[model samples]
Target: MSLMSDIIAKAKARRMRIALPEGSDERTLRAARILTDGQIAEIILLGQPDKLNAQAKTLGFTLDGIEIVEPVTSAAYETYVDEYVQLRQHKGMTRKEALEVMKDTVFFAAMMVRNGIAHGAVSGAANTTAHVMRAGIQCVGVAEGFKTVSSFFMMILPEFRGEHHVPYFFADAALVPNPDASQLADIAIATADNWKALVGTDPNVAMLSFSTKGSATHPDVDKVIEATQLIHARRPDLNVDGELQFDAAVIPSIGERKSPGSPVAGHANVLIFPDLDAGNIAYKITQRFGKAEAIGPFVQGLNRSFNDLSRGCSTEDIVNTVAVAAVISQAQA
Candidate 1:
């Protein structure tokens, strides 16, 4: 089965908890309703209860088995406040302000996951990337071994006339603006882990650049080469190669010609760009012009599971992301 099918099957069997801070957007509401009715998991929506109820009724929707936790009533508030105070103790945060910040739906939702009230979180359809991550850092923080947060795009490409519909993974597009060698190493590690879980395949990561190997003499190309070596040194077990042009990374003939003896040369599933500008543009071009469907900008490396959504995402995006979150929660469990 495909990744989506696998996640859906897991959703049917496990009672995953998903926290949506933006609450009642049409896509979120629709996704939550579908999950609840289909026995996918328990969805905890963040916001005022009466407002959510009214909106649901107006849209001819039913809350039914879904759980709604308003900011005031959430058990996570206390937990978040404590964590926030600790994380920001050096930054001079009062307990009262910490409590107030916890009331913010995103913070509260992250706290829910931090305190085990929810399994994972999905937000950013109604908030900025930094704000969503801030809620996560100040509350749940980064994953055990991960030092910083990284992001990826779980892009889905549809088949067309004998073409294959394989999903591609691109990383650090929505976070880590310009990663240094160390940050690049972290990105490679995180992307490798996520690929194993979501795509069920070992990622042969390509550290993409405009030049392949030492064929070109540019500082930018040299940077990619350095990052690749750093990543390899840090994670010797990971199958990764760098200083590769796009064609060399994906095309077997070109890859073989460029890097004669590399495991990740010809077939790379996870593509890591050197900087955000290149990463973001490459993915967008593929998503729009290349006829690929983009699913994430999913935040990784957090202590707990917290995902973000584009404001313009569809109901299907919400559903897929929630499923991704479910997988993450299960993996963390």
Candidate 2:
């Protein structure tokens, strides 16, 4: 099955609760209907109930059993604000300021995940990436014992061979512009763990570079090499190698010719780019020229599930992103 189909199936099997913070948005409301009708998730919309209903009617949609909730009016609203005050007390936030911030749908949805009221949240349709991420970091925080928060794009390519073409995941493409050695290592580890959970495959991590092994030398190549060493030292059980060129990382002929005897070379299903410039450019090229289907820009490394969607996303994109967040919840479970 295609990655998205597999993702939908996985999400339905999990039957998690997904919080939609932008219920007033036509696309999100519609996506919630699809998720609810398909029985994939228990859809909870954060908005004014009456306005949500009226908006749905105007859009020719029937909300049916879908639930609409306004964050400011919720019984848990005060509790959330108090918690936020404590969470950000170091910032010198006042109760009054906290209350106003809590009213934001992004913060509300993230608090829901923090409180276990929802398994995950999907937002950023009507918000910027910065705002959504700030809410998540302040409320949900990063996964336990991890320092960096990164992202990945699940790239499903056309069959490479008969039966060996599993989907590939590209990492740090949409977040963390220029990572140092330690941060890069954290991203690789997070990507590997995420892949094992959502993709259901043993992760073979490839830390990408323009030079294979020590064939060439540059500061950028050194960073990948250092990240590789860090990952190997920290996670000995994970199969990974780095400072490898693109051709050596995926193609057997090139891999054997250059970096033979490496476990991950030519067999990598998860690729970690050296920096955002390379990763963002490479994934776009793959999507456009290679005709690969890119399924995510999922924010990874959160303790609970919360994701930022592209403001340019469609209703279908929102649906897929919700499924991705649900899948992340399943991994935690």
Candidate 3:
């Protein structure tokens, strides 16, 4: 099955609790309605209950059976506050100072997930990327053994001329602008983990550069090679290889000729670029010129589930991101 189909299957098999912070937005309201009514999961919308309901009515969105929580007035507020205090105790801040920092809607939403009130938290469509990451790191506290929060873009390409191409996911475009070898290794591992969860396939990770098995030479290409080795050292069980060009990564013939014995050669489902410039450009080209429908810029590796928007996001973008967040929440659960 295709990756997206596999994702849909996984989501259907398990109902994941997705906490939508800033639930008053039109897109969030619509997603909440769809998720709840479609039996996707329990969507806990974080905001004032009355305001959410009133906005739902105004937007003509039905939010049947979707849970609503206002951290300010929730019966569980004290629990969240206490957790926040504990997490921030090392900062030399008093309880009041900590409370002030955690007052942001995203922070509270993440607290809900951290404390097991929800499975995962989704924000950043209405907030900045840095803010969402900070809240997640402080609250959910990264997955076991994951030191950094990396991210990726999942592209659902459109069917063209009666043939549908497989969905492709690319990594670390929106967050880390220029990743070093170690950071690239983190990106590879995180992307692999996300691929396993969202796509339910043991992903073959390919570290891509302009060079292919020493066929070309560049400092950046060396970085990809080093990153590939680091990822192997860290996660030997993962199928990965690098210092390959894009064609070598995906085309069996080229890959065989270039990197004959590499595990991910010509079979990589997850492509990790050497830097942000390549990742951002490749996905956009695939979307705009290649006519692919892009799903994310889904932020991964955070302590909790928090995604970012392009600041140019549409309603469909919002819907897909929420679905991605739901998948992540389910996987972690």
For model 2, the stretches where C-alpha displacement exceeds 4 angstroms are 161-166
Could you tell me every candidate's TM-score relative to the true structure?
0.92, 0.97, 0.91
lDDT tens digits, residue span 200-317, model 1:
7788999998888888888777777888888777778888998888888877778899898878887888999989998999889998898887768788898778988777878778
Which residues of candidate 1, in runs, are more than 4 Å off?
159-163
User: Worst 10-residue stretch by lDDT in candidate 3?
Assistant: 158-167
Report the Cα lDDT for candidate 3: 0.79
lDDT of each: 0.82, 0.90, 0.79
How many steric overlaps are in each model, in order? 3, 0, 1
Residue 239 lDDT, candidate 3, scale 0-100 = 90
